[model samples]
Target: MLVVDDNSNPFEMSCAIEIFGLARPELGRELYDFRLCAAEPETRMRDGFFTLTGVAGPEAAESADTLIVPNRPDTHVPRSQRVLDVIRRAHARGARLVGFCSGAFTLAEAGLLDGRRAACHWMWADAFRARFPRVRLEADVLFVDDGDILTASGSASALDLGLHLVRRDHGAEIANHVSRRLVFAAHRDGGQRQFVERPVPAVPDESLGPLLAWAQERLGEPLTVSGLAARAAVSPATLHRRFRNQLGTTPLAWLTGERVALACRLIERGEERLDVVAARSGLGTAANLRARLRRETGLSPSAYRKRFGAGPAQPTAAGGSGP
Candidate 1:
């Protein structure tokens, strides 16, 4: 993996480093041969936060299997022709491409994102669509995984995309380990809405943390929206509103997502029987598990198991036994 830096934002760049560049000796193997490349020898970072130097030149991008494009704060500023040329060549050679935040602009400017689905920061959605009308922009998503190319909606969503890439390259168990090390959620559906009613509520709103934790532990049970509402001492309508305001999803959607995730982990841990996996994950029946797994992962139960089941057991981040 190579990060192409051309006056990029430090936060998104750091997210790439943290997710792909960092060594995972705890896992007993390196995840990626990560490197940083720049179009110029001395590149000024976003808002002049700092100057980056001592990185490989643009030529390094040609050898990388994956290229992470730059995300600059000034979206209106035209990217350097040299940088654009490098991205174009890399894409021509079939290397996986990534864009974080305004990096979507850089990819689209290079003419790689036209006629392809992508995501960018919601604040720039209109401008991106206006500038590149051919690209199918999913402004509501946290990220878009269009096979070889991916884009993230915001600076923080960069981590979400990075973890997703890790899960794609490795497996759910390994991705869970890496996410645990970062103290982040193991998975956030790419289709989840990026917008929130209020980033920081003017008045403190009731937190759903306790309720969420309670529900996670009971996913194997016959959990229902009414049951969750009852547990929270709130009406079903109030629970739905809170879920939408705080989590950007409905309670039913969140519950279904959790159950699917649990099913995936169980499968990755070498559970062979579909009926057993379904029951343990609260999916109820093998037929339902098959449908939900295929919808969420694009793989049937047996296929998913075949891909992720043969790996050695990975230890937990807290030095605990593997699940």
Candidate 2:
């Protein structure tokens, strides 16, 4: 695994370390050999008045099966040619290229993202589009898994992308096992919209935050638009209008999206019993979960599991973050 580190936030870098460096040998898996490659061979990072040293050089990516570009510090600025060259070499040699968060900028700079759909932090969506006009930028999503080229929004989305790569390499079962260990969801459909900032819709003085939090806590219980509205002490009409205005969706649609998100986590964690996955995700039935997964991701639960649920010994396409 090749991890290309830039002047990236250590928080994002830690996400990579957590996903790639940690090994699970109990299941007889050949875990990623993670390498931290620095463009200049050695660099210094400020970690709260402490200096962190970079030991690995760009050549660390030479033999990698998968290359991961972590988020860079600046989204609007162009990257160095040295960084571009490293990326080009990896791509030409058929290494899978992944950009997490602003790392998409580095990929775009290398011209690898030309004519391809890439995901970036939605906060920098406009700048990313303006800078890389040749690249098809999908601003409203968590990530994009387009075959060998994968890009993800920063923050928690990096974990989502890493788990996706795990699933792609090993299969869902292994990825789910990792998720269970990490207390995270294994497969979050990369298409969920990035939390973009928008003008708050004009609605009643009522707050949706509390209601949404309450709903999250009761995901296992039956939740309906009417039920939620009752809990929020609002009329059904007011609630629907408020949801549409504030969230850009009806209450029912929003609820379903939330449930599906939960279901995806449960499914990724090897909650193989469809009934259990459904109940946990609040979908209520195996059929419902199957239908929802299919509609959202074009894959049945079993098919998804089959493709991405294998144990973690499978060979990667190339260039992830370890030795």
TM-score quality measure for candidate 2: 0.68
Candidate 2: where is the Cα deviation over 4 Å?
A: 24-31, 46-54, 74-78, 163-222, 235-291, 295-298, 307-323
Which 10 residues in a row give candidate 2 its minimum summed lDDT? 314-323
For model 1, how does the per-residue alpha-carbon lDDT over 1-323 read when each residue is reduced to its tens digit?
Answer: 44556567888888888888777888787667777888888988877778999988887777666888888878888988998998888788877888999989999999999899999999999999999999999999999999888999998899999988877676677788989989988888888889866456444536788899999998999999999999988899988988888778899999998898889889988899999999999999999999999888788988888877867543221001100
- Winning model by TM-score: 1
Please give, for residues 223-290, the per-residue lDDT of candidate 2 as tens digits. Answer: 98889989989899988876654554568777786787677666666668999989987899899999
Output the number of the lDDT-best candidate: 1
What is the Å distance of residue 244 in model 1 from its true position?
1.0
Could you report the Cα RMSD, in angstroms, for every candidate shown? 4.7, 5.4
